[model samples]
Structure formats: C-alpha cells, structure tokens
Target: MTLFSPLHLREVTLPNRIGISPMCMYASQDGQVSDFHVAHLGRFALGGAGLVIAEATAVHPHGRISPFDTGLWSDEQVPGWRRVTALVAASGSVPGVQLGHAGRRAAVREPWRAGAPLDETDAAAGFAPWPLVAPSALPAGPGHAMPAELTARQIAHSVQDWHDAAVRAVSAGFRFIELHGAHGYLLHSFLSPVSNRRTDRYGGSAENRLRYPLEVVAAVRDAIGDGIPLSFRVSAVDGAEGGSGIEETVHIARRLAAAGVDLIDTSSGGITTDRSTDTRIRRGFAFHADFSRRIRDEAGVPTATVGLVVDAEQAERLLDHGDADMVLLGRQVLDDPNWPHHARIALGDDSHDSWDVRYGSALGPRARTLARLTASGETPLTRFSP
Candidate 1:
C-alpha cells in the first residue's frame, strides 16, 4: 500500500497513512486548552493530515510535564477538546489523543527553558514544583529531585485516572486513544530496570515490570470500548546504560498487543536526563524504522515509525518495505501544515484535487498558469534575472 492509502483500524478508517505525531505545544493555562489549541491542531486537519493526534494530555494534574501542558483530568476540559475534535473531523481527518503521566519527568520547565526541574525560585514566581512520583524513589538525573515511590493504592488510583481520562476523551469526540507508555514516563519508568529499582510486583522481573502498563492498557481499552482504536507509544530501546533493548521491547510489545493495543508508535531514548550518560540511537532518516519493523514482525502488531520521516517517498518506502504500517510526522508537518497535500504533488498527483476546495480552487488555477508559462518558454523570474 502507498502512503495515501486508507488504513482501517477497528471501526475507524484513517483517510491516509500519514499521521500528525502528538507534539506538546506547552501553551495551555492550568491544563485548560485555549483557542490557540483549536487553531493549532485544526490547521493540520485543514492541511490534509489523515489523522491528527493531540499532544500528551495529562490524565491527572500532577502528571503534567510542564505547568502549561494540556490535561483531561476533569469534565471542564472536555468542551475545549470537543472543539478540536469536531473541527478535525469536519476537515476529514480522524481525531485522536494521547493520555500520559510524566511521573518523575513532571514539574519541569518547557523545552525552550532547557526543561530543568522547577524549584523554589520558580515557585515564588507562581510556577511551583509539585512532587513527582514513580515506581521507585529515583531522580531522573543528577540534579532532579528523587521522586516519591508510588504506593500500591496510589498506583491503582492512577490506573483509574487513565480510564477516566479515556472516557473523557471519548466524550470529547476522539475516535482513537493512545497511551503514552514511553520516554521514561511513568509506564516506561516501571518497564525499565535502569529507572525502576523496586522489589515489589510492579518492578523487578520483566513480567513484573509489565504489570502496571498492562493494567493501564486494559483499563483504557475497556473504557473506550472495543470499537475505538487503542495505540501505545513505546521507547523501543532505552538507549542508555543497563537499559532495556529491542528483545525486551518485543516482549513488551507482544504483551501490549495481547492486552488490546492496536498500534505501537515506535520511538527511542529519553530514559535518562543526563546528556552524557544518555546513549542515543543513530539519528537518521526514518530512524525508528528498524525498531518499528521488528515490533510489527516479531510482536505481530501494526506499528507506526517516527523520527525524521520528512517526505512522502520515504514514508511510502517504509510502508512498501513492511517497515511500518503508518508513518508519523512531527516537525515536518509543523514546518508545512499542508505537507500531506504537497506530498501528493511530489508523488506525481499535480491536480491538487486532494486539497480542501477553498485551497484547491485557488491553487489549481495558479499551478496551471505556471505550467502554461513554462510551456511557452517564458519564466516568471526571466524578466528579473540579470
């Protein structure tokens, strides 16, 4: 199948294989989405994105990555998200949301501020640092505070929170739900031995480490019902010393598939905060292809490859070669919200018919005029060139 092909996942059909990867805008106010979010996310849908997944929305307020990150913790947040989903759906794109808990990564500043953990000075400035939680009482890095270990009761409550958030996501009109089980967040922290040092049922052996995330997947799956597609994003490899590898991730993927995860959005690294100690995989075009392909084949689950997937040909090649079932674009789409439509032209469909009528009607005549000018051996820049 080509990049433009439709992907039928459960009861939902994505209009095309190219999906907008959830990239945190960090523009919310106390977890409430504003008009900025509606305008920001709506553009991709208007620009021809087949699926638009909202950023990592915290299931609980304490799980926020930054004070400004969006959340779905209460009913008040539903109406705002409903506006986004409604606009996206009206634009002929499937709307999805990623529910996440940042765990020890919480209470940090935005990426532009170097993502440093907030402290008293920031608290005085009204950006107070909240207590972080994890499976073990360990800091994400040297300077970060050691997070409080989550009690069994608290862990159970967190699972319920995910379920509640999934219900809210459904109420907000999202057809797909993804659980953020990656990047050294709460679920990934529990899965990795490097971050999790607990001796309880939620830690230790690989199967034990799989406990909490599986519970979350099951809870979310049940909450959203069997009709909506459920996706799980995983850091395919920890990319750090003593971290889990592909084989371990494969095991996790197999369990996740069994637990009702439909797609694995393969990503890597982010397990540790220390840049020096953090080992990163090669940053190449479609960097996650091998990881995604392996998970798709070995785990027998559909996969979506991210990381440097910039163009249509590369995305099509990945799917054609069985590297992934879909390709997710993050920064590329940010650079050009209409990249999907542009890709159609790059792939030889020059009619611009796929574009929304408002854009196509205008652009179509301009494209023909340019072609006619070129055919007549007259260039628009010929008169200006020295």
Candidate 2:
C-alpha cells in the first residue's frame, strides 16, 4: 500500500489514505463552529485530504476543554458543522468529527496561554471556570479544580450524552465519527489506572476501567447506526507510572473492534496533565507506528497513526512497511494545507494530476518551467555566481 492508495472503511471509500488529524482550533463560540472553521477545514479538503476529520467536539457543554471548544450537545451547533461538511464533500473528501469530553482536564485556557486551568483572573475576563467530572474525584494538575466523581446515574446520563452527540454529528453531515479517548480526556481518564481511582464497577480492575468508555462506544454506535463508520482514538500508553501499557491498549483495540468500532485511531499520552511524570513516545516521524502496528497485528483491526508525519516518503514508508492502514497529518498539514497535493508531486505525480484543477491548472505549468530552469543550471543563486 502507498500513501495515495484508497482505504475502504465499511461503505466509505477514502480516495487516499492521508487524513487531516482532528486538531482543535478553539475558535468556536457557544459550541458553534464559525466562518474561521469553515475556511480552516475546507482548505484542507480542497488541498486533497482524503478524509478531513473536524476537531474534538464536546458532547456536553461542560465537557469542553475550554469555553471556546466546539460542541455537539445541542442542535444549534449542527447547522454550523453542516456548512463545513458540505464544503469538504464538494472537494471530494470524507468529513469526520471526533466526539470527546475533557473530563477533569476541562476548564483550561487555550494552549497559547499556557493551557492553565481557568482562574478568577479569567472569570473576570468573561470565561468562567466550570465544574469538572471524572471517574474519581481528582484534579488534572496543580491549578486545576477537583472534579466530582461521576455517580452510576450520572455515568448512564453521560453515555446517553455521547449517543445524542453522535446522532447530532450524523445530522451535521459527518460521514465518519471518532471518539477521542486519548489525551487525558474523560474517556481516556476512565481507561487509565492513574486517573481512575474509583472503587465501583467502573474503576478497580482493567476490565472495570474500560467499562465507562465501552458503554460510550456502544451508545455512539447505537446512535450512528450500522452504516456509518465509528473510530476510537486511544492513548496506547498512559505516559505515567502505574498506567496501562501498549499490551493493554492492544487488548482495548480488540474489544473496540468487537464493539463495532471499525478502526483504531492510535495515539498516546494524555492520561495525566503532570508533565513531570510524562513518558510519551518522542515526537519523531511516524512516532506512533509501533503502537499502531501492534494494535493492527495483535487485535486484527485497521489503525491510523499520527504524530510528526511530515514528509511524503516517510508517510508512504509507514504504509509500505505495514505500520498502519492510514496516516493522519496534523501540524504538517496545517503548515501546508496542500501537503497531500504536494506529496503527490513528490511521489511522481509530477503533472499535478491529483491536485484540484484550480491549483493544478496553474501549478502544472509552473513545475515544467522550474524543471526547465534547473536543467539549464539556472539556480536562484546562479545569477550572482558570475
């Protein structure tokens, strides 16, 4: 398999394996996506991402990591997403959305402002800190507020919350839905031993810890139905002591597949907000390949690997070597929305056949001109060589 190869997940056939990783823009208002999100996401689709998954959208308003995070909790938010999905589909890319709950990690500032928990100083600025909920009553970090332990009744309600969000996602025109069970999020918190300190059926053993997230999976699947594809993103390692490991994640992947999840969006390290104890895999090219490879092979499920996958050859090699079924690009794609189209050129599609005609019609000729100039020894610095 190559980077440009098509991937069939259920009834959805991605024209290529490259996908835009769901990176939160934190630019929404009242959980509604704005014009900024439209241009931001649509550009990637127009640039040639086979699948464009929108950022981690909260299922509940309080589930938001920040006041600005997108939400699927209400119908009001669905119309905004519809505009985005329509644009992505027009550009021939499948639109997807990642459903998530921040858990105890909620009520924080954006990453630009140090991502600290909101305080009175911020509350005065119109962003009030909200209560947090988790598997146990614990704070995410030093300055974070302590979260209330979710009762059995609340957990059941939360499960339905996910179901309702998934239903909203479908209505919003997303063909694919991914559960963000990574990065210290509510779902990940429950899965990790470090975060889940509860004594009930939802906590103690590994099986118990997986309970809440699995219920969510079932709920989402029931909401979206058999025709739509469901993907689960997992923090393959908790990146903290006394937490689940790769082997445990592989087992989780197996269970997820059994629960009707079509793919595992393999990621890592969000189980703790404590950087002091962080042991996440280093961010290198295709860093999550090992985790994804193990899950795909051991659990016999399709997996997508992300993290620092910047180059065309690097992404292609991951697929060629069976590291993952697909590769998701985040920062790299953000840097150049047309990375997929550029990658096509790098991988021998020199005529810009894959790029949208709007771009290809111009870039096609530019390539020939540049090549001709190079053959004639006309480098940018050549004019000064004399």
TM-score versus the correct structure, for each prediction: 0.98, 0.97
Candidate 2 shows a clash count of 2
Q: Which candidate is the best by lDDT?
A: 1
Candidate 2 lDDT trough over 10 residues, lowest sum:
277-286
**For residue 97, what is the lDDT in candidate 2?**
97
Worst 10 residues of 1 by lDDT: 269-278
Off by over 4 Å in 2: 379-386
Give candidate 1 regions above 4 Å deviation.
none
Model 2: lDDT to the true structure: 0.93
lDDT by residue (256-299, candidate 1, tens digit) is 99999999999998888978778899899999999999999999
Query: Model 2 over residues 285-331: C-alpha lDDT tens digits?
Result: 77899999999999999999999999999999999888999999999
